[model samples]
Target: MIEAVRVSGLTKTYPARRGSAHVVAAKDVSFSLAEGESLGLVGESGSGKTTVARMLVGLAHPDSGTIVINGRTRERKDHGRSARLRRAKEVQMVFQDPYGSLDRRLSVETALRDVLRWHMPDPAKGTVRARIAELMDYVGLSEKHLGSRPHQLSGGQRQRVAIAKALAVDPAVLVLDEAVSALDVSVQAQILTLLNRIRAETGVSLVFVTHDLAVVGEVTGEILVMYKGEAVEHGATAEVLRRPRHPYTDMLLSSAPGPDWHPERVSELRAAFAGTR
Candidate 1:
């Protein structure tokens, strides 16, 4: 399989106070994805999942690490603006907040047009409006919604726009941070279906970061469990969820609602896991 992304010994630290020790956000957190494949990074808050997403998209700089996207190695700081823009075009990010991710002032067409204008030259092979129409169509949005602002559409609609914008650049990898967490259950399912279709059609590799195991199960085949800024477990999604070897993975599984959910079982798992620590 062709490698889409490979991250080695990635770590990031933030200074908290002048006298106090620094806070570590990601510690030796490393993983990789293959072309046309999907992987899920699951953990609760402060698990450094978001930090990993930020690092992948170049939104945050890593203290120490190696990130190779597609085939090019990424520098921690030395890549110039043009190089960074090329990287950005290669790997795009779809943020969690639908409304917050998009500019409310711009209409749907304009929002997509703005991204196309950046990556594509003026008078691009196709007109900007024509490209915008294709993107909206691909994302299941009709041309009638072209003039609608984010507030005018439902949460799911706004999210579709975000996804379209990410696809605008034709990136090889897409880092989706809780992309469907804000939508209703039905809407979430629709979005997931759309994503699966997109992946199947475009062969775009995905790095899905979310706290919901069920959501992860639906979209990803492989799983990486993170805890306290470190990767605690990694394996096939079904195997990990069915027979979690790590305490953190087991704890996350036990806490989730399921057909066999028993109060005592979760407590026993928690107690056993705590004893190990």
Candidate 2:
């Protein structure tokens, strides 16, 4: 399988308030995604999972390291129009909050059409409308939805629109930064199923970043366990979930709600978490 994204020695740092003080957001982080493969980045809050996602989609620049997308290395400064455009075409991001991500003022048609104009300008003007309708249908939306504003839609509908917008560019990699985290449990399940169906049909690599291990295990085959700006453990989803090597990872799994919650596990996990802190 061809690698869709390769990050080697990826690092990011922020200046602290004190002199010569700095906060490391990500350090020596490395991972890769194969075409059509889903990799879940699991970590607690401030674990740099979202930072990695931002870097992958070019929203945030790494302090040091290389981001090779589809075999081309992306430069931090001025990445040039050609490089920026290429990055935009190949990588797309789905934000955590669907309601917040959409522009309430714009109709679904306008939202999608604007992205099409920016990313896929070569399509004929007449065909663009047809393509918009087709995309809406692909994401389980109807013509009536095209005229509706984001406020008129439910959370699930809004998320579907976000997915449609990401698909508009036909990107090779979809970086989902807590994409379904805001939805209710039932809605989250539906969205996860939708994502799986889309991936199976379109063959797009999915980078699912989330704090919920159970959610990640449901959708992703591979897992990258991140803690304190670094990947503590990397392996298959089932293996890592079943037999977590890192203490932080074990704590996360044990703390995650399950059908039969164990008080002993919760106590153990809490103790582990306190120790880490």
Candidate 3:
């Protein structure tokens, strides 16, 4: 399979702050994303999943690693206005809070128009409108909804708009950092279904970062489980979920809600696991 994104020996460490020791956000994490493939990066809070997503989209710099997006190696010199815009074109990130990512003052149409105008060469009124219409269609929104602002839309609608904005640039990779975690279960399912359809239609690679194993199982083919900033297990999503190798992976799987879920069992396992780590 052709690689659309690759990260090798990825590591990042935040400096020590007042009365706090330095934190190693990620360490020697390496993974490759096949063209049009979805990879799930799963772990609990502080497992470095979000850090990886940030690094992939150039939001956070890696201390030591190479990130090749769309076959272009990201370098330290990839700074400044032009390179930043170029990077944005290669990869776009959909944040957890849909409202936070969008402009409250701008209508959905205006928000999408700004992105298309900034990214597209033509930027013509007619062309921009056509593209905005196309984007709304892609995200399952109607023309009437385009005139609504972020506050006017529901949680799911706002998320759809966010997804549309990310796709406006026609990015090679889309990093979803807890993108659907903020929605209700029904809304979550809708967003996941929408994501699956979008992936099928666009052929864009996806790096789905979330702590929920169940969520990843629905949308991702491959899974990478992280523990304490290290990848403890990586393989086909079904296989890993069926027969998790690492202890941390097993703990995570057992904690997920299921027919036989036991909250007390989860607590015991978590406590036991914490002692080992």
Give the best candidate by TM-score: 3
User: Each candidate's TM vs. the true structure?
Assistant: 0.95, 0.94, 0.97
Task: Tell me how many clashing residue pairs each candidate has.
Answer: 0, 0, 0
Q: Per-residue lDDT of 1-277 in model 1, one digit per residue for the tens?
A: 9999999999999898988977898999888899889999999999999899898988898999899988988876557768777887778888789766699899988888878877776575668878888899999999999999999999899999999999998999998999999889999999999999998899999999999999999999899999878999999999998899998898888788889888898999889988987
Candidate 2, 1-277: lDDT as tens digits: 8998898999999888767777799999998988888999999899999998999988899989999888888877746777777887889999888765589899999999898888766886688898898888988889989999988999889999999998988899999989888899999999999999888899899999999887898899999999889999999999999898888888888778778779898898778777876
From the highest TM-score down, the ranking of the candidates is: 3, 1, 2
Q: Once superposed on the true structure, which residue ranges of model 3 sit more than 4 Å away at CA?
A: none
Candidate that beats the other on TM-score, 1 or 3, i.e. the better one = 3
Candidate 2 Cα errors over 4 Å, as ranges: 18-21, 79-82, 273-277
Q: Report the error of model 3 at residue 12, Å.
A: 0.5
Q: State the C-alpha lDDT per candidate.
A: 0.89, 0.89, 0.91
* lDDT top scorer: 3
lDDT of 1 at 101: 69
